[model samples]
Target: MSVAFIDSHMVEKFVENSQAFDKCIEERFNMLDMNQDGVLSRDELQNDANDSSFVELALQSKEEVDSLYDVLFEKFDTEKKGGLNRNEFGLLMKEVMLAKAHGFGETPVCVIFQEDSLLRRVV
Candidate 1:
């Protein structure tokens, strides 16, 4: 893991760069896919969530985190197919990155991004 200071401007620039953003998201999706299948199942998503310690989720209890992941998985599974395709995963990343950008505002915050994490790629 490595630490870096990230602000909204940095995140916005990364998001605006469509090619880089898409590439990073695609790589992350593939990493989380686990089974080499084109689609990501709920179990795969849950496992990824459980494996990663997200900054925002640090304060939440296990039950709360599980519930949150369920909601997030449902949001990403837009087709109601019980799995997330590459396109759906891309959309999910877009929203998540945008949300982080907005949440950061003008302040730079210290963050420890895990190796292979999307935030690390953004930086």
Candidate 2:
């Protein structure tokens, strides 16, 4: 992991550059597609999702965590299908990044992001 200073402005600039943002999203989606298939199954997403200390820190209890995941999965599965296609994954990622950016608004935070992490790539 590497420490980086990040804030809303920097993230907003990255998102505003559509070409770069799309490229980054594509890269991240590909990485998350664990079975080498173009579609991402709920299981695939949950595999990586299990390690989110950030979410655990914010939520008060296990029930909250489970409920949040359920809600998120339902939201991401826009087609009502069991899996997320590239476009759906892209949309979900864009929203997630933007939300993160909004949370960091005007406040620079020191974060330790994994080398291959999306946040690290964004920075």
Instruction: Give each model a TM-score.
Output: 0.85, 0.83
What does candidate 2 score on TM? 0.83
Worst 10 residues of 1 by lDDT: 49-58
**Winning model by TM-score:** 1
Q: Write the per-residue lDDT of candidate 1 for residues 17-92, one digit (tens) a residue.
A: 9999988888888888989898988788767766565655667888888797678777788888888999998888
Tens digit of per-residue lDDT, candidate 2, span 50-112:
666355535557677667667876988887777888888888888888998999988899988
Worst 10 residues of 2 by lDDT: 51-60
RMSD of each: 2.0, 2.4
| Whole-model alpha-carbon lDDT for candidate 2 | 0.80
Cα lDDT, all candidates: 0.83, 0.80
